[model samples]
Target: MSSTPINKPSALQADKASATTSANLPEHISLSKWEDSGFEWAGQVASRSFERLNALLTTEHLQSDLEIKANLYRRNNVLHLSFTLTGEVWLTCQRCLQPIAIDLTDDYDIALLDNESQVRLVGEEQDCLLLDEIITEPAPERLLPLKKLVEDEILLKTPMAPKHDDCEMSVEQFGEIPEEEENENPFAALASLKGKL
Candidate 1:
């Protein structure tokens, strides 16, 4: 298994070049190897690479690439993963009918377990993830796709209703409510009929 150096200048340059073209991490990674060696990688990935994420975006043009740093290691027999993501995406402002840039950043940690039964063994305070959820292949050769995990993290961090912090609520955008004229009264005819009676 190949491992990228965390602090080496050469590795950093390679990572930067690789990130612009494609993701540096393999599509499927061996969890055991990474856990045993405490593997880590840090780089940037093109925002356009995330297909599912692009669907929600208002514009195809991205201001910046998604920065990512991930580490896999074992702690007390339980495999743990820690990762951080930072990026900017264009989302349509719910308040205004215009595209707005939203900055995203998230740092998270989770415990990986082989089965659902083991979740309780890890204790309730720590977040636990089942290998089956991440593993795509069957049986003895279990591999996890890091890109999917990264995309999922981005999706989770995204706001349900994206809006600018300083967005001005415009009446034109959400059509102004028409004011009722004082002269026009539906009850006026009813009053006239009652007077006649």
Candidate 2:
């Protein structure tokens, strides 16, 4: 009988793995290159999720191990951003009144637009994001922060009131239940006095 040895990865190994995954991701990108060459960018980010989320998430103390994948490319004269975010977030369960870990995985897509006029033209018929700065007539070479864009997508997908679907909670969580006993109406006594008069 041959015994096989199991080797566990060291902390350094894990860090290297994460570094390799995030190596290709850029915090910023040139809009001109993205549009002209139809450049494609893909990267992974592992960090404290809530800092990037800002006010979008009401819950605090979310786990620091967040993983997000972003892909940006230009197609059909339109810039497309695709993001996949996965993390264990802490949210106060409405029913349980206890903190629960919610596994979140969101895939979002947005069409990037350079002008407000384009937004008006596109309207709600399409998912569009207007660039913060105007893309001059010739579309000058300008770098856009990819992190901000990715954060916006994550915020949009976060839940407003996160709660467990199967949380076991009594009606008391909402409010005190009224007793079934009926009370004598004050109007009844007034009506009796009026009848005697």
Candidate 3:
């Protein structure tokens, strides 16, 4: 997180797309159009940077309906990108181990794309490529396997179920958990007579 600054969505190159190519662009995403980041995938054209998620990419939960947004741009003879992910998911409690279904909003830093003869692919890190002043063949177009990325991300990040900090078992029924042994005298009445003596 140190080397990679928490850049606002403006740093992405997709912002430029909104200003320049209004005709070509589709229903544009109004949130932060990250222009500095980039993405790449097979067959598709270059990509813009996808906005990284705010939450940690851990075993969380993925909503039944998942929606993710990404951006693509060209840089250094290569396609770059950034993107964001949003949706709801079901989760289990950590402590109680009960199901705690909740919606989630996450972002990703798409940095590279694999471009074989067709297009390039991008990763989650700062991946750059040679775009200008290149003597070699026209660098393959960068593309993002968004479906795979989304599926993988959702699978990896989404948890089976949400969890709570404490156990759910009620006091009346301890369930499987055993109770502590109580300390008591075996013969309190006899012991009382001995004490008197």
Model 2 ranges with Cα > 4 A deviation: 1-27, 39-41, 47-64, 97-99, 116-125, 133-141, 170-184
lDDT of 1 by residue, 67-101 (tens): 88877766656777778887778888888768888
Q: Sort by TM-score, best first: what order?
A: 1, 2, 3
Segments in model 1 whose C-alpha atoms lie over 4 Å from true places: 1-25, 120-123, 173-197
- Please say which candidate is ahead in lDDT: 2 or 3: 2
Where is model 2 poorest over a 10-residue stretch in terms of lDDT? 1-10
Task: In candidate 2, list every pair of residues with a backbone clash.
Answer: none
Best by TM-score: 1
Model 3 segments more than 4 A misplaced: 1-64, 94-97, 113-144, 159-162, 166-197
| Model 1, residue pairs in steric clash | none
- Give all TM-scores, in the order shown: 0.69, 0.57, 0.37
- Writing each residue's lDDT as its tens digit, candidate 3 over 80-166 gives 445565655545565554456555567655434334421333333453433222213232442234444444455556555445545
The local distance difference test score of each candidate is: 0.71, 0.57, 0.42
Q: How would you encode candidate 2's per-residue C-alpha lDDT over 81-134 as one tens digit per residue?
A: 666777655656777767766566777767777665655544375677766642
Minimum summed lDDT over a 10-residue window in model 1 is located at 1-10
